[model samples]
Target: MKKLLKVLSILIFISAAAFTIQFYFNKTHPKIQVELKDNALSCNLKYSGLEGSVDFTKDEKNNYYIAYKDRIQVIGKNGKSCDIMKDPVLDIHSIDYSKDNLYYSSGDKIYRYNLKQGKNTVLLKNIPNYGDYKDSLLRINGDCIYISIGSATNSAVVGDDNKWVKENFYAHDVTPEDITLGGINFGKYRRGAFQSYNTRSLKGQIVPKHFPGNASVITYDINNGNSETFAWGIRNINGMDFTSTNKLICSVGGMENRGSRPVVGDTDYIYEIKKGIWYGWPDYSGGDPVISPKFKSVKGSPLQFVLDNHPSTNPPAPLYQHKNVGTLGSIAVDSSGNLKSKDCIFFYDNSDNMIYSSRGAGSPLAEIELGKNSIISSMKICDESLMILDEKEGYLYSIKRGKVNAGTEIGRNIYLYLLLTVILSIILILKNQNS
Candidate 1:
């Protein structure tokens, strides 16, 4: 009995002490992994934040391109690069190549940079960016250039007489047909002011033919320089891509924590964007119609189609609905067979200090969980390795599989956990022997 008590006390004391040390002192360092909950993926820092949105180019000699705001640098594996163009335009959100020309987005314009001719041309300009939703992601597939535009305001419920709307629409030469063309309502889509949750009423609303109210995916035919809306009714979708099925998959970041961004528990999602369809925004969240929580109305629209802009047709469902993702960076498709999925979508949420990869449905799997409040500005996959830009440090990191670093969840000092286990085992052994 005495030996048993002694062993129990020793184990308890040792466990308590080790746990305290792990909790109070253990610090997370740079480690990469297949999943945030998994072991370390080998990590190595490469470039600075100056190397902007990472993408590979058609040019075989220069495999990758990074937009550094001031210039586009084409780089090789060993750090050799040449300036494609110097700050040709500031605020470049994304950069890519289509045949002979390079495509990049700066604010509302999709600038066509001719690689062969070495000249700059504004492919499409005067796009709308209302609220804090102006992170344009440019993707070029074949001859068409796709641009994902974020909303101008949170809900964009400006009254019919909003001067900004009139000016912006007129400047862009949007016609009544264009507004009504996508079955989109203009003038006022929302019934109430920019407050919390309000009951949606599409009745008695007036509008022009075309409504450029919120988020939209547009395509510019590089051959004709003519652009058209691909999809609409999205809030802020910075990370979107086309899958092998010729369909779209985008990470839609809804209602952020800010003024008028109603915290109705609306989370983030991976949207499968379809043509001529409105993926819910403002009045809906996570593929279901939702009454803004501010409305204080417990009773709301049905889970699926809450407030219908188009009652006849249902909005496309989310590919994967994530829980409250913020500051979503540009998305990349993983074709690196080394990864579990042949074609998986990966994105970073600066708000969560985590990177995510699409895993069918449910929650997007956390690929790499970063620490020290490291903000991931951009990410790109190269061969067996994944490269990431840490905005806070302005450093880029390359990650591949490595031995899992245990005790990250319990604490960073994995040795402590091991030592504690060993101590407990020895105590048990001694106690048994004594008995």
Candidate 2:
């Protein structure tokens, strides 16, 4: 009996210790984060006014290249600005400055513009423009180019009030089973309008169709010009990145302005893209099952017409939830020595106009405020600070640590740590006695 009691004591001790550690992490993280957030240094910026929807890329020589409207502009450190476009490229969304070429994505294709040769080659074509979300979010990995494409319809259903439904109403006959993301959990996602259409155009009577070559993210090979789907079912992953381990992580936008859905409190998400996993769009939001208005006992179109017929499985939860962040611009994993770890992700919300640094669940955030109504279009880490582009304000600003704010995060953190430790220790002691 004594031996059994001792064994139980040991087991309880270990389990309680583990639980307490996790509890401490969950508790102390936010408190420390609040302190750090409160004491966060205001943005220190070297401002340069730019024009249009400016996208930036830095070359090896540390020169800043900006693509806007109809030209490619290069701004030198000595305050000289020059246009470098051989031809005016309309609607320049993304640009990458490599040693051999200047790669840019516009319209329905990616162009590899050879600098010395002065030639343009079509790397990938037939890309989908799903409403306005098809901005061709682009980035250059080692030997390839990655781009994100959004869905074709709102909430993957033809609602009575949607504008797209009124226009392309005949194009889609979609169900949940059409998603087919090729994973363990296939039943969770309702594929959108882009996934429903057979082609960009309709030939005969429009029925439900799967748009060919329509994927969320695609990789373009520079050598042979072959492109492949990196992942799918991201809904509208506006901004994405290849991490240090080359794994894709992206920021997904929530559905808003849909005639049938709620708009104001919609939640956006940032996720690490595990290939073939669906990040619950149209069917789910903010790790919770999206309650379609039609699914309610309303005896209406959404309920009586669609919900009973849909067969999609459950969708996956997000890495982090950003409440009220409607349109996310760009996501960069910060390696700068700012907070605790280097893998923390810093993402900008164009709608919110704030830069948030987070590492999934139970991690602290270091938020830097920008001016109100300022749209933080894109960001890049340079010299341990963020080179932020406020496209609406037409200014390139720098955000970095100045002086550590008034109260100390360190001293309070230590006190809380000890307090939690003592509380847990006392609880464990009581538990042992009862056992």
Candidate 3:
């Protein structure tokens, strides 16, 4: 009887010890499975317990500024943090740091928060935010701040696919340039492109260009305060970054199968952005027209071109196509030379919870796996360490070369958990043998 009590005490002690270590002391040491390359990397859990954090940026002083839905906070190396700005009304989307200012988008406005003066001033306003793809991403490249605005609806029409119709009935897609519609109405309301859900259009009806319109990358000059469309017809660019060669690259999400103009077998893509170029959307996917039989719905009729004419019928093709990747987000170029090449880029797959390192190829050289439950919202390479924010797990993981931590901490807790269980089983077996 006393042997049984002794065994129980030992098991209870082991359980308590493991719980304390996992919750308090275990600073998750993760691993990177670099299957393609022979690169030795170290992954570490830099920060944890951030639930609502959306995006983050680092300054020259190593201070990490993280943006949440309601506030933005600056955290130091010592794990201490304080809110730099707070607003309950702000639904902050993306963030970028340049010089001494941090720029971010919230709702329909972009604000620049100056670090020296501790003030945030509105940089731009009236961005279209009343649609399905409303995340406005901004990146600072030299004197140009490139901002991406998403289309208001799927394939230009505000049909039953839009859940925002109940709240904003009159909201629909806007054009960056004047476009002549084909006058094809969708759904029972017979709504057309560039109009409200209840409105219709005639053939050759012109939709004038609106400033800061959807489906475009707008470049705002910091010195001159001038903004112009850099490129148009980008369906929904969730990720944007400049390569080491000063070329802009974006990860664009393709059309889904759940819209009025449902496009089957659509795949997300990465594109090299060129100034004054139009990457096709609504009427095209990956530079191919939607009228192609490949885009036809599985059970429904074929898709027809919605535009009477296009700015450029021959748009540039995608640099890389991510087959079966649901939505790609947060692209980062490795300018720090930590990877094999300076031009190597890393992007997140929101559906698969994996990060891939690619050099503009159809297949990735290596992939960073964060399991199935992780939702990597944003990632960047800073100080030679790749910093990734897992929004679902509420942790910021860092990956570097062999210069930092000695071992990988990926699944380290599970190893300990299993080890304790094995020890308990052995003790129980020996106790039974003696009895």
Best by TM-score: 3
lDDT of each: 0.59, 0.59, 0.81
Per-model TM values vs. the true structure? 0.67, 0.67, 0.86
Stretches off by above 4 angstroms in model 1 are: 1-41, 48-58, 159-203, 211-213, 256-263, 292-313, 325-327, 401-435
lDDT of 2: 0.59
Shift in Å, residue 128, candidate 2: 0.9
Lowest summed lDDT window (length 10), candidate 1: 175-184
Which is better, 1 or 3, measured by TM-score? 3
Candidate 2 pairs with clashing backbones:
173-208, 187-312, 187-313, 188-313, 188-314, 196-209, 197-209, 197-211
Candidate 2 lDDT, 1-435, residue by residue in tens: 665566567656765766666567445332221112435443443445674755787776666788786677777776677877746656678888677688887877778777678687777776765353557878887878777777655555434444554555454323212432211111124322323322231222223323323326777777677776666556677676655677677888876645333333466788777655545555565545545441332122232112222233566667887765566768777654453256678887666456678777675354765667577667776666667776776777655567532333443355566566667756765666687
Model 1, span 1-435: residue lDDT tens: 777677777777767777667556433233332234545455554454342343433344545666756577776767776887987547776777767677887876778888788999887666665335665877776688777877655444333333454554322222212221121222223323221122233433333435333477887788877777778777777676665565677778865433322334567777778777767565565666554342222222112222223422446667776655566666666755355476678877767677777756555777777866565656656556666766565556666677433433444455657586867768686858866
- Model 3 over residues 64-157: C-alpha lDDT tens digits? 9999997998998777999989999999989989898999999999899999999989989999977988879888889889999999887787
**What are the candidates' C-alpha RMSDs?**
10.5, 18.4, 4.5
TM-score of 3: 0.86
RMSD, candidate 1, Å? 10.5
Error of 1 at 51 (Å): 6.7
